[model samples]
Target chain A: MKMSFEHRDGLGLLRVEEPRIDASVAIQFKDRFHDLTQNGTGDVILDLSQVDFLDSSGLGALVGARKLLGAGRVLELCGLTPTVDRVMVLTRMHTVFPIHPDLVTALATRAATS
Target chain B: MTGPGPIPGVIGPRPWGLTLRFAATPVAVRAALSAVDAGLADAGAPDDLRARAQIALAEACNNIVEHAYPRHPPPTEAHIRLDIAADLGGLQITLRDRGRAMPDGPLPGRELPPLDPGDIAGLPEGGFGWAILRDMTRAISLSRRNGQNILRFRLPHADKPGPLSRIVT
Candidate 1:
């Protein structure tokens, strides 16, 4: 359930420092996301490189975090592992978020645009 | 959401099979899924197959923990039992629990929650479990009897073609 947050280049970078985000930690993950990004105005990018597994509850938490960020601000995702990517595709959630291949690309793209 | 009867004959003792029981709790279900994933890897399951197995199994077991075993009153001794058997065809999974029957005495329909991009507030966070289960496994069935719920499904091996797709490429 550990997560690290950084506000850089007017973007909120939240990295989940855990291997799996399942039912056991979904609630904590959403709460932490809210706590970290509640005051930020810019878009938030979630890094899922370290997370190998994400169940439906975890997916729900991700959606919840996005709602917490509000409608105007987008909650982007990056570095989804194979399984996580599969889940996103199967659920058609990949269409909902702007996904980047990695953190560097996400940051660089955002920085270049802004 | 299709079949609702006794688990198929395929779910029985096999030399390569394993059985385990754990309390019907999120933490324990997580541990059980992790153990099963490792076991699949150890049994030489391909990455794609293993991933699908883990994902589908997680949704099913979590449903039991979330729905079958209500947390309000919290049954005295609720537990989930898993029977996993691996073969050249694929893996067979039978999940059993004695807590509560499904709401309507049948499996829930396999409809994915709508993801209306425009309606951010109306987007669904849950109800994706059944759709995920439907996508990952085959011959999935559910049955409730004697105050027990039995769920069965088969995960195909990566290299093995399914019954309908057995033609050689």
Candidate 2:
């Protein structure tokens, strides 16, 4: 699970650098995502522009990461690749997390609120 | 896929068909899928079939790894055979395993998760795999034959992918 993280004050962003998120990296993705965003405040946008494919395990990991974040912090998603975005919508995961078309929109939502 | 070639392991050669076996481990998932994609590429399989098969087969193979050898009894091996038809009209994949059968004897006919938008508690975390297999592939069948769990499916599509809703699948 190749990834890079950027944090400023309480706002944080995690960009996943992988083409496919399947069973092989599902668990790793969840653990690393949670560990990276565990200390953040406000909103954390997960960028998945590079992910072309995602499976059930990856979905589960995302959902689990959301749950692990508890209720205070927001684990929003942004920049979902078309293929990855489709799976998220198909599973109604878009219902669970606020999905933005890109990072700018995700940050804009945060700005509008705060 | 010139004329069925010869049956696997028979008299002559089987140039168009390929079979592979893997240990029932998560690592085998990538290896098996990459090999199948390469094989399909060699046979000129369309992107649609190649795309769907990638997901469906992942679910199938992962199912084998997760369910075949639960936790107590240890794991076994899984087999995959990719066969292109005589005229190259379509492709067939047969996945074989020596492990346990599906809990319900066959995969359940599950639909996409219900449309519940607001309620986090009502949101689903899993159970989308089999639905993906059913929606992506044209035909799918699972059975137990001679103490071997056999799952064979077909990808007969020749066009581009469908709309975003199908992508959700």
Candidate 3:
């Protein structure tokens, strides 16, 4: 799994290019989360546009990232494929993290807020 | 006591058998499922049973990769073996892992909690695995032996209606 990170203004964008974010890839995801939070940037937008499939472990990684980001920080997800989106909905994680249709909207919302 | 208790289905002519070993990584789950799907097609298993088997196997393998080997380096190893009776009356699959032994506990059994209506819309992400296995398979067994945890599951043959009278009455 390869993750690219970029920061524009105050909003941080992390794009994951992994096809499957199931059990096997959870650790790598966790590691990336650790790297992202090391800077203490609190606000993040995860662009999952490239992820097609996700299971419980992937969900755990997202939830874990949210917890690590702390109260003031925010973690929003964008660009979920239908299958991945269904998994999120099935797990009810769709409610836990604010999800947007695309990265543009996600960043726009953050820009508007900040 | 002595040797490994006779490999599960050695008696008589074993109807169907499949053995595969793959890197204990997530990708292997998809590969394993594809192999199972192909094998079932060759064996002429019912479509529904094949689909269910694939889902169950994938979920079981995912659990092994995630829970058993959390945070481990890449290239760990796992093994899978499957046997299906000719009569289609029984299907057995075994998954073995060399990672840390899983916590010994009662095997997750049937009896799913009702899917709450409100919660259904935003299903909790984490706990769906065991539920999927419980719903899909007839029997599930887990054990730790020889420094490895082996999980096995079985599905009974589909029941056929005995007669028109039995079905109607």
Candidate 4:
């Protein structure tokens, strides 16, 4: 569960360094992300470009991370591999989370909406 | 969602298969996925097929890890067996576990909840494992025998029906 955090323009960018975010690291992922976002004032956006695979546990962890943020904060997902995107769609997670095609696009959209 | 549809009669020994036994733990799930990656590489499976297989396998394996053991005194050693059938045209993964059976005595339905972005509480976080499996694979069969649950998932590399698919159908 390797992650790199960057702060830019009042937004927190968390890039998951691993290629597979599956059952193997689901718990660690949830815990680590929660810890990093403990004082997350700005909205957090996750970059899943390196992650080509995701399972149900991983999906649960993503939602759990969101719930951990409570109501005001936000967690967005960006740059999902096709397989990951398909799983999100099939599981109806596409509607739950705000997904962007890429990180640049995600940031731009946030800027526009904000 | 569908019942254990038709299973193949040719249940002979699979010569071109890789069997890995691991404890029902998170670390073991990674090792199992790596083993599947190796088997797919050896069989020259396409990237798309490999990706789909990994996703489905992870979901299935995780389900066993999370629910196989009783909750009261969480057993640590709920063993799981993964068998990868890589016989040229099609790929199949057979998972066996001797722990707990489905509470209702059947595979759970894989239907996802209705899409409603407005209500976050209504959106389900879990219960998406089985549905993801069905979406990824062409056929999935589950049968419990001799106190062991056997789940088989098949993915064909080519569109044309191979001998194995024909036999199964």
Question: What is the Å distance of residue B115 in model 2 from its true position?
Answer: 6.2
Among residues 3 or more apart in sequence or in different chains, the pairs in candidate 2 whose N, CA or C atoms overlap within 3 Å are: none
Q: Write down the worst ten-residue block by lDDT for model 4 chain B.
A: B4-13
- lDDT winner between candidates 3 and 4: 4
lDDT of 2 by residue, B39-89 (tens): 666555556566666777888887777787666334344444433342244
CAPRI grade, predicted model 2: acceptable
lDDT of 3 by residue, A12-90 (tens): 8889987767676777898887786669575788889998656667776777677677667778899998656754654
lDDT of 1 by residue, A33-70 (tens): 99999999998899999999999999999999888888
Docking quality level of the chain pair in candidate 3: incorrect
State the lDDT of candidate 4 residue by residue for B1-169, as single tens digits. Answer: 3322111222222345678998788777888788878766555456777777788788888887777754634466678999876654567789999987766655655666455666655556687887777666766778879999888888765534333223223
Runs with alpha carbons beyond 4 Å of true place in candidate 1: B1-15, B159-169
Q: Which ten residues in a row have the lowest lDDT in candidate 3 chain A?
A: A86-95
TM-score of chain A of each: 0.96, 0.91, 0.92, 0.96
Please list the residue runs of candidate 2 whose C-alpha ends up more than 4 Å from where it truly belongs after superposition.
A112-114, B1-17, B72-89, B104-106, B113-115, B158-169
For residues B1-169, could you state the per-residue lDDT of candidate 1 as single tens digits? 2322211222322335668899888888889888887775555556787788789889998999998887844575889999987765677899999977776755665677767977788878999998778777888888888888999998876534332122111
After superposition, the stretches of candidate 4 with alpha carbons farther than 4 Å from their true spots are: B1-15, B71-77, B87-89, B158-169
Q: What is the TM-score of chain B in candidate 2?
A: 0.73
| Alpha-carbon RMSD of each model | 7.0, 5.4, 10.4, 7.8
Error of 1 at B128 (Å): 0.4
lDDT of 4 at B29: 80
lDDT of each: 0.82, 0.71, 0.66, 0.76
